[model samples]
Target: MYRWLLLSYPRDYRRKRGAEILETVRDTAVTHRGTRVAANLVRHGLRARLGRPASRTVVLWATVFTLACGLFTASFGTWLTWLGSRPLDHDELAVAVNQLYPDKPVSHIDRDDPPSVFIIYGSPLSWSSASDLLLGDGGEYSLAGLGASFEQLPADSRPRVLAELLQRLRASGWDDTEAVYSNAYDCVPDDPRCDPATIPSNITVYAQRGDDILEVSINDDSTTPKMSLALTRSTPWSAYPVGVVAFVLGALSGWCLFGWASRRLEVRGPLAQGSAKFLFGFAMVMWWAPILLSTSLMLSHHLSEPHPRWHPLWEWLGQPAMSLAFLCGCLALGVAALSHRLPADQTLAHP
Candidate 1:
């Protein structure tokens, strides 16, 4: 067990001090000493992986880069897991709609049948659509789902319909949550001028069975649909663990790579080092800015509605949609790597 834990350290560090570390661990192998030593080994091993032990700035930047890598990795893992789950087919969606409202066939319908499970501009990710992803229709990227709208649903009958639907879904082996009621418009809850009784509240219910989710929304907003239904697949159970493991691995990789670049550049001349810094800055801005923007927007959207199952992590990070930005960041990193070799004569040997 102690030997296995030592693998966390860098290859050179392990070769030099592996025996000494194992000897110390065995010497302190009392009831709880082994556990404590194991934890310390992992912590320090990770710290050793990032070379500048004396510089606090290195640790801080390493942490930031690691976290960014982890987020993107987790999103990618979640997206892969999503691909394994089944999408709602046309027949399945039709049946669900019919079951919900047998008397009234849904008049207006919108289905999510994108070329790819994760889509940008109704198509698979490609460089040709860079314009759409960045400036045209990036916001359109979303997971596949089925949606229907009822523009003429009577307000008086909404309560009865919702009640019956809930009872029916429950009887049919579907698990459900209590309906959430909130104002359809932007009304300040604490404002005396905004009368609660005067404002119409929307009704929303969420139900689940297996990996599938159903959302029923009844709204009173004049511009919005009167009633809407959305059917989508929930994130698979395996995705959680996969995402977590991917995040940890990605963080380690990011830290190690950053440390290598930092240490290598320290011995180089001004031009190479300066180029690396500028390229890294541009890459970070490209990669991280879209994540921040998309995360905020997705959070607000979820808060505005009753989202039983949140959208995939990639969507929140502005994935395939902002894949162009991610690609640009990668190119910058590649250029930075090239810059390291430009001034071979100025490079000095360093430990």
Candidate 2:
């Protein structure tokens, strides 16, 4: 660990002093002096990286990195929000229907130039709850949603449509097996689309391929002929290798930016103690902790079925946590920058 971490130092410095540092670490192994060594290595590493970076370059890239972090965080947050709200059972059918025909009219509609929340086409059950979360100056034009409706179809065509859907799904890499019927899935409490009036008294068939899930229902709720189908795709983001990329980038860049700012403050006066500076710098990086906590909360919900009451805690903390962390780091930086003056008594000498 010590050796690897030491490699973070400037290449030339490491080349000259790497063996000496390692020998010293071995000599002081029982006392465990490696922490101090690693800390100095990083301090020197920063100096090396900064190797006379112009003020303009520093300010410009700092802004770029900060903006990049914000963009990434926003994107990741949107993705997480969308991922969290993905339709599971009956809701999926509703969303799929809405997307299939968004131009269809509905009631109780809320509209926005780029909407955050709106109900799509249908009577009571068809009005899908949709949010154009991606709309704004830099808005996302796409939507992830669910909607449902009872369409007239002959009883004879029911088997044919289902069989055709099954064949297509199988051809598209879905499992050949179909899900067993369950009366227990009668009505979902949160879904207004599952109002118990539109769904049939007959059996429902569910099929799946990875994250893609398809459901077909035979509803005799209406006096006339009608069939119910709901399709949903719920992606558990944190599980996939690509899914966590945003979270990882958010946390890492946040740490690095905070670290860089705090280091600048530390090196202002006399040669700051390497250990103290590192601790302070690292502590500043923990501002991203709130984001991590929120992410964990979301992941827990995705990974498990339990809806613990404490789940709201995660939502509540999501932004506040990041805010608090950023606030604390800024407060520290402000104080340090304000108090720190140019070094006149001592200078940081080569270790």
Candidate 3:
């Protein structure tokens, strides 16, 4: 076990002192001591990679990663804005009255603050004495393809409208819809969180027709029932901005650590800043490289042939490929750095 752990260090470090390290581990065979040694080994190994010369491939991939990340982040907001601005599929309300809405007049409200149900938009408390209000769950509409109708409707009326919608959806012709009940549809049937069994308060129905899918969830406890209509074609582009933000923050953190390691080496010893920085950056961002590279490859492969179902396989390989590339990169750079550095501070190199 310690032999494998020592292998985590740069090959040069191991070559010079592998036997001595092994002897130390044998002498101090305590489990906690072994864990501490493993941690130090990893730290020193990764740090050592930062003082080496990088190859052309390393520099090329690093530049690609940085530019691709920068471009994706820069354009992510625009993508989200475009997605938000997409024109909703507005069919004749007259035709949809029996299918989606009640036979009541839809109240006019602000475009940003639309109604939850087919009828009026008001708080349940505002008119609690009169009628049951239907409150629209603003986000559920985005998923169900309801566009944002429920936002303005009275909360008490929500259950009534939701139940009506569900009944109509179930009665509609579903032969064509069943053939295309895909994961792309709204309120995904396979979504574990949205499972009807989990939400004991809600009576749920999922019905698909043509490009439209309706998810009616009437919570027995809450006056408002969640109803959503979804378009299968409307992909989840809304998630782009969020993913871009997370990717940027993670990449930035890794880049900073790499820079710090390289800078420290430059100040303390004879380290090649140019190559070390190149390799370190490459290793740091290679986690996203598979995703970036595979997307194009998959697209091209799809266009050339017809691989609609191979996407999951490629996605599965992305993380593992990233980890392997990063590890190999670190080891390669570590070997190069140790060989190139002057012998003046060999002691410093050990740490």
Best by lDDT: 1
Off by over 4 Å in 3: 1-86, 89-97, 101-167, 170-199, 203-213, 222-233, 236-351
lDDT of each: 0.79, 0.47, 0.44
Give lDDT for model 1: 0.79
Q: Model 2 — TM-score against the truth? A: 0.35
Q: Write the per-residue lDDT of candidate 1 for residues 1-351, one digit (tens) a residue.
A: 989998778788899999998888887776466678889988888788777677777777678778889998888888788888776675666767777677875766765454556555556767786777766476676776678876776667778768887987787667888898878777777999888788888888898878778888888765544778887778788899999999988887888888777767777888887788799889988888988999999999988766668888887887766877888899998999774344346767799
Q: By lDDT, highest first, what's the ranking?
A: 1, 2, 3
Clashes of each: 0, 13, 25
lDDT of 3 by residue, 1-351 (tens): 777876545566679988987887677666557678777765555444444454334334434445444444434443344345434344522244334555544432123322322122233123442222212222111221343223233445645655555455656563212111112223557777676544434334445444343443443334433433333222334445655674576444444344334435655443465566566566545545655676777667656532212332223224222435545555755653554434574454464
lDDT tens readout by residue for model 2, 218-287: 5543445554554445344432433346545664465455445544544554444344344445434644
- Name the better of 1 and 3 by lDDT: 1
